[model samples]
Target: EAGVAQSPRYKIIEKRQSVAFWCNPISGHATLYWYQQILGQGPKLLIQFQNNGVVDDSQLPKDRFSAERLKGVDSTLKIQPAKLEDSAVYLCASSTRQTEQYFGPGTRLTVT
Candidate 1:
């Protein structure tokens, strides 16, 4: 089976700028997730979507970060007024209920 796909594998921008990342999940997967992984830290769940509806987003920094899963397949994560601390890899994953998740390569952001 194919894996998740993310575009613009790397990005560099000044703090306070805006950046967006895109993701496409594996076919027929119902649950999708977005995660932020800072260097030396484990990945943190930023959001989870089930069939285009948000299942969880308690960890997301709403003031500057936003995400959406459209039609339960493709997803996008955005950061406005990006911060230096926000420099991290943005990962996307998908899974069936009660199954292990498969993650994408991730988008690495470097805040200058």
Candidate 2:
């Protein structure tokens, strides 16, 4: 099977600017996730979707970040007025129930 696909492998932006990252998961995967990994920490789950419906978003920074899965196939993560603290690698992953997640290459965001 083909792996997950993400666009713009790298991004650099000024603080308070806006950015968006796109992802296309493996065909037929029912669960999609977005995660953020800072320099020294593990990837933290930012949001999760089960077939176009959000399952968890408590960890997401609602004030500035948002995400959605469309038709349960493609997903996008967006940050508006991004902060310096938001500089991180944004990863997209997908899986079936109770299965291992396949991650994309990730979009590396740098907020100056």
Candidate 3:
């Protein structure tokens, strides 16, 4: 199977600016997730999708963070008016009910 794909592995922006990250998960996976990982900390789930519907987005900061998976294949995460504390690795991962989860390299965002 092909691996997870992500782009712009690194990004730098000033506080209150905006940024977005993209992800294309492996073929045939039924579950997708977007997570924020702080330095030296475990990844925290931001949003989760089962097919094209949102299964969970309890941790997502609705005021500034938003995401979508229109075709259930590729997804995008956007943060408007980004904050300095938003600096972290944004990871995209996928899994099937019968398989283990796989992660992408992640987009590391830095806010000044």
Candidate 4:
């Protein structure tokens, strides 16, 4: 099966600027999750979607971030007015309620 896909691998942005990331989950998977992983820590769930419908988004910082999964296959995460503390790895994972989740290489964000 094809693995998850993410873009840019790395990103550098000034504080208070804007940036975005993209993701494509595995085929036949219905559950997709986005996670933010800071240095020296575990990945934190940012948002979750099941077939175009959000199942969880409580941890996402809506004040400066937004996300969408229109077709339920691909998704995008955006940050406007980026903060210095917003620098982290944005990871996308997918599962079919069975085995371990497969994660992408991730987009490493650096805020200057």
* lDDT score at residue 25, model 4, on the 0-100 scale: 91
Q: Of the pair 3 and 4, which is ahead by lDDT?
A: 3
Q: Residue by residue across 20-40, what tens digits does model 3's lDDT show? A: 999999999989999999999
Q: Candidate 1: which stretches are off by over 4 Å?
A: none
Tens digits of per-residue lDDT for model 4, 6-107? 998999999989999999999988888999999999999999988899999999999999999988899999999999999999999988883668899899
lDDT for model 4 comes to: 0.92
What lDDT would each prediction earn against the true structure? 0.94, 0.95, 0.95, 0.92
Better by lDDT, candidate 4 or 1 = 1
Q: Model 4 Cα displacement at 56 (Å)? A: 0.6
Candidate 2 residue pairs in clash (backbone atoms < 3 Å): none
For all predicted structures, in order, the TM-scores are: 0.97, 0.97, 0.96, 0.95
Supply candidate 4's per-residue lDDT for 102: 85
Looking at model 4, residue 90 earns an lDDT score of 96
Q: Which is better, 1 or 4, measured by TM-score?
A: 1
Instruction: Give lDDT: candidate 3, residue 96.
Output: 90
Better of 2 and 4 by TM-score: 2
